[model samples]
Target: MANEIAGLVVIVTGASAGIGRATAVSLAKLGANVVVTGRRAERLTALVDDLADFPGRRLVVPGDIQDEQLAQELVNRAVAEFGRLDVLVNNAGLGHHSALAEMPLADVRTILDTNVIGLLAVTQTAVAHMKAQGSGQIINVSSIVGQRPFPHNGIYSASKTAVNFITRTLRMELRPYNITVSLVYPGLTATEFGQAKLGQSGGNRFGLQGIPAQRVGDAIVKAVRYGRTEVYVTLFDWLFTHINRLFPQSIDWILTRRS
Candidate 1:
């Protein structure tokens, strides 16, 4: 029998904190050799040290995934150090807020580049390794915004929408080689990811209570092991998004300050 994700070689980007950190730690606990990558070397080092007894090896490759070349190098390093790449968790991302009119082109580009293109760059290389292996799993960390546009979150929603689309495409495209793609769209989670600022403070204390990051990490572990197309970490989040589609502008009347 195959390893069933246990003792698998997994690569996780943006593993410094939030969902990425939790996911890396969880995968490690599941007997996976997880390669954690991010721009913050210190944070990565701390996580690496913490998971010292995580059943499998852990390595930290610090860098910005926005750089396509560096993205390739990340895969090379993981393959070189771990000897195989069974799963790639494209979790490195940032979320920002600003009215579309006031949104800086630079800011817009940053969101698109990091969330969209940056993810694609790493995923491209991951697929290459998986294809060679003849079987693998790619779990793209998306958002509830991907399925439905929410107030004060246009560009972020669009980028996630792109991720959602690409994930479905990858599933169909890679199926020939037995590669599976799982899109994990999480709702309110108590991570820096839910913050108003990128990896900063502020979260969804009002709309819907957030969940612990460990819950999502555990879910990813299950998805990787069982093979799922797309999953929402919370039922409420999934319901909220489905409602938003039928009533897009309905929430505008809520006039929530934080939006």
Candidate 2:
């Protein structure tokens, strides 16, 4: 299965940092030609530099995922460069830490625009290419918060829950085209996600404790190779999700106590 990953062309959004950055490097190291996109030009350049010694090739396209044009261009560039599109890892997202009622409209817009709209745009573009090619993989990096909403993260949770629904719908819609749509729900990852929204001090209270971003990256690769439909990076997280589903009131009680 490891050889299945080699020489495949991939695109990873939010490649400048966090899970996106880690997944891009991990895929490249596994011998997959990678196209990385993000808002930070220098950081994307630095990521390419970091992967210089890897077996596969790399392309850096720096831009925000919120632009529909950027999403189309990313797919066009991947096909133009690699001759075929094999995988897309949709990892770009933002978090807003506040009650839904108290959250700023600007922050709400930012979260929905980038996390939900941007992801759907990118997926539509990629699915078009995958339909033409007859086979492809899409791994969307969601979060545990989406499955079980917590206090103060209501907006971010909505965005990811939306992603979860989109992933499920695409899985059924694209199956005929041999396109595999996978959702990756990560727990609290040690990344700049919270800081981007809440600044340093407030960011710490956004969710559960942190784990390394590489764990999510690693899960993504495994899902791609094995054709997994859903992945939770930690067993504990997976268990938590199922437990919440089986006993919603119990989980709600637990969260109520935590808050």
Q: Pick the candidate with the highest lDDT.
A: 2
Q: What are the runs in model 1 whose C-alpha is more than 4 Å off?
A: 1-3, 194-208, 246-259
TM-score of candidate 1 on Cα atoms, chains taken together:
0.91
For model 2, the stretches where C-alpha displacement exceeds 4 angstroms are: 1-3, 198-208
Lowest summed lDDT window (length 10), candidate 2: 198-207
In candidate 1, what are the lDDT values of residues 1-259, reduced to their tens digit? 2346677999998899888999998888878899999989999999999989768898888998778787888999999997789899998888876566667788788888899999999989988888998988899999987887654567888999999999999899999999989999988777866553542243343666679988888778778877876888888877877877787767544535446
lDDT string for model 2 (7-90, tens) is 999999999999999998889899999999999999999989989999988888878888889998898988998899899999
TM-score of each: 0.91, 0.95
The local lDDT score (0 to 100) that residue 96 gets in candidate 1 is 70
